[model samples]
Target: MPEKYHISTTPVPPRLPRIGKYGIVDWREDCARCHNCVKKACVYDRHRQESAYLRTLKYSNFLFFECMGCFYCVQNCTKELLALTINSEYENLGNQYWTPEIIQTTWQQAETASVPVSGAGYRGKFAGRGFDAMWTDMSEIVRPTRDGIHGREYISTSVDIGRKPAHLEFKEGRIVSETPEILDIPIPLILDMNPPEFTLPRLEPFILEAVRMTDIIAIVDSTKWPECLNEKQRQRMDAYLPNIAFHLNSEAPEIPKDVLRKTRMVEIPDSDDALDRRAALREAVPGIVVSIRVPLNKRGVDRAVALVDQGADVIHGVADFNGNEINVKNPRFIKDMIREIHTRLINSGARDQVTLIAGGGIALPEHMAKALLCGADVVSSYLPFMIALECRLCSDCKPGLSCPAGLEAIGFDYGVGRMRNLIAAWYLQLIELMGAMGMREARRLRGDVGRAMFFEQMEEEIFGTLFGTRKQA
Candidate 1:
């Protein structure tokens, strides 16, 4: 067996003070001077830490808003002076899709490189939209240390990319079939290029460094060639080639043979001649995996299945930045689209011959595992890395606009360290999730909907016949 995969992480503190969710309001004027102050009984000891933190505070507007909202002090306070307040800054973190809680959780994981733990149990809605409507089966969780994050058991998160032959013909002496080319990575993740909305800073070098540290692949635009690299990076460009897969659009210039030869994969836009393009690329660079970037719009499912039927190596079905289907009034979410495509491929008997890469709205670590369960061989991660650099998913992230996160001023070490930390945290979380699900291999998690339950499907089975059918709101 190969060595166990691990990601080394160091705590990368946030540059600015975090906008925590909950805070405490103390009405000291009405205090009865009780012997046992309610603040002293905080399970997390946040009140004492808040007092200590305020002593060295430079800004009066900055509040100690790290309350866990356990409600122990609120209920036990004799004077009824203590109240829990939600931070307004926290409420305004992201848009409707990228909720403030998601941003905050991403920040915590990136800073600490550890799983975000809430003292109170999950208080959010049971099910809502997209990935929220799907839940993995954790009925097999038996022990605390069995999660494999602490080395109790080995849970493999590795997956293979590229085309795979359905079966091999065996001769009397040895195998007589030809094996297709494939690229195996330690993790089933690919750092995708930033969407057009997040055009804040040029941190390509840092992203490439993070990819190198994690030993995963990153997709880069072919048009942004050497401009994305600095002089030092250009000198050692060969070292980063294997981790980089240039995305070739129609407008991209012709890539030199030398560059394509060094890289393991490349992605081209979905077009009428996409198969021809794949053939030409394979002929140019033998053993190179070519992924067709299919936009997950209304026609995405059929396009992806068609490509798979035509012997494409990989189909990268991408949605809008927020994971919604583009150019549709009632757009299906990424999860639904992925399920459709995966189901189609499975029915056509081409699922095993081609690899399906899903992208868009993979904001959380659980989304990675969930995407695999929905049938993606790998997932493309985009916004999380930007959020790791403290991006607020603001509308004004253009070149000249004022960035609330101050992304342009970030140093190389701080930027790269945070991204690396986020990746490590996600990796460990994936391991924990796999262990809880009683799964030992990430490859087995693909298309394994038996280990998951869909809200729509369950609603249909349980209540559809009784109440007619669920109507769209």
Candidate 2:
């Protein structure tokens, strides 16, 4: 047995005024002004914090909306002067995919580094799009000893990110076949570079810091090296080098041999000669894991299978930010793409040899586990870390635009702390989810659709013969 993987976290509060779901509306005009006010009896002490916040309020439109919606005050008020109201600003956060609720929940997790306990049960739809269309099996919750977060049992969330030989040969009672180097990370997550749509200057250092603290890998574009760092950070580059994986493209300048040798993994964009490039890279740096970044476009599914057939070590399939296929109408989701790729590889007897990394649209911790359940060895995150830095996903996120989050003005400690907290929250949540699913290992969770229920499969089983068949998006 090995030492359990743990992520130590401390509460890192938000700098900006929190955009919570519920707020208190006091109709002071009809107040009885009782000495024993209901506001005085808040178990969470939210009323006292709101009073302090109101005294130093800077933004007129931003009100203190930290009410927990316990409804104790609403029920106890004699004059019926108190009511719980929804915060308009909170409702307006993010688009349909990245809902306001998701953004607010991310904020809370980043701030507290704890699993969110919505006192009220889930009030959303029974079924929806994307990962929401599938639900994990939690029947094991009946057994308390299955809980891995506690000391009852140990659940392994670690995953390997390199190729494995399908079979081995022995000569003279010893293995004669060559052994491949395997890189194992405690978690099945890799922090990816933020999309060009919304980028903050001098933010890479904080991302690198979070990756280093978490002991995971971060995919960094090799073209922007040194330019993204300052004098002090550049001097301390060696310390950050081990946790970083350089991403190379056709247009990017050549990376030095020393940097590539220091890192455990490298990623290159998919091209006509992608396999040739992988072979060249492997020859240059022996035992280094090479990943091919494949965009989840029209040919993504076939392309992934083709790459595997050609002996690709790792294939990283990236969908759009919203998890849909790129440049296609009524696009298929990444979950479906992953299932297709996994099925293809398995049919070819190559699934265990090559690694699959899914990226884009992995916005939450559950999304991480869900992606694995859909057959990804690892999932990459780009937006969740940005959301940790108070990013509102506003229209003004581009360069030369006014960032509503003030991401440019934040210091390294504040930025890195929040990101680390978000990772910790996700780590704990993954463990709890795995425990509830009665899974003792992350690798076993891959393509374990038997432990998951898909709405499409259920609908088809119940109504498909009646309706002929429903079209897939």
Candidate 3:
């Protein structure tokens, strides 16, 4: 007989309920009283004695305590029974891409504010979209007894979002600054906005303040003002503008002739003569960054190359806020798009000079790490804010103030705190994820590119040539 997984050897977490009406329901319907009673013949004999449990009306015994839902009984049962079913608990982790397992895992960590465990031992599908298609490199498990967090041998998964100079010279035998190209962030997460989903002025301001206080820039579109707010709220926007970075007015960009700008960077839609246009844009407004917005798609590589050639200070590649790829055909997906652009930039020797800001498809905290493997310096997101606000993904915010998530009328302080807590939780989880991946510093992770494993590539490596053909030489 073939070996069994998820049972006999691995133990169920005691935190879960041991026995209840919820239990034994499956066993009674599926049990067969064969001589072996194959259901009783567990590999470890973990099944309880048939006579020890309460007998049921159906003439089948109920051994509620011993069944692990491992499907071992189902496999061996002559009655052809045993199945797993939903228990009517929390269903959504949000969005089709994020999946219940990932959200459940992250939320479990956030709710307890602690590390997670593989208690069920990976009860999900192996292949899917975005970061789900790639995995982190954890082959070398250097168990350091002395220092668990800062082990002797580890992987660094942190990243930075600025440029680096080629070479530096100590002018007077002292540390005179060379070219300061790179601005290193301690963590790889960035704060971005979906203003249509969040209408609170106070909430946005507080979120910006918190992020800027941590030296993390918040990406907001400032044109969402209702024109009905009091003067103080309007002023708050101006005050925060200079402090938090902005992704302003990409659809119909309007940089004033005098460039009355407060933002450190601006990510506009991709335009022709992008390089010369950026030079002119910078000339119009000094000390302001010029970024080009790239769609997160399979064509990410081509778009990135064009943007870089045009001299974009940054490339803000955004997938749909719900984490879907733009193109249906040849959907290389967002995680791979980031990696494709990163590798393209690295191969061109320009990775150190430009920032890659990837948003969209960033559903989980660990998506930040997955983004890093694809060579992004920073990752930004939105739906996490909705999830933070207890958004059930009913998708109602698009038509004016009819949001089903209740964001249209959400209280300022409560909504803001919830958003802050979500970001804060993500921050802690980011640290834990980076630490687990064997990384200590965040800046060294910029375009690190090797932090994850691509299952597609792995599949090709394992069976592509055996069953399929490689491109002709």
Number of clashing pairs per prediction, in order: 0, 0, 10
**Steric clash count of candidate 2:** 0
* lDDT of each residue in 306-358, candidate 2, tens digit only: 99998897999999888889889889999999999999899999999989999
- Candidates sorted on lDDT, descending: 1, 2, 3
Model 3, TM vs. native: 0.69
lDDT of each: 0.89, 0.88, 0.57
> How many angstroms is residue 239 displaced in model 3 relative to the true structure, after the best TM-score fit?
6.4
Off by over 4 Å in 1: 30-35, 59-61, 143-152, 170-176
Q: Estimate each model's TM-score.
A: 0.94, 0.96, 0.69
Off by over 4 Å in 2: 144-147, 465-473
Models sorted by TM-score, best on top: 2, 1, 3
Q: Quantify how close model 1 is to the true structure by its C-alpha RMSD in Å.
A: 2.1
Q: Which scores higher on lDDT, 1 or 3?
A: 1
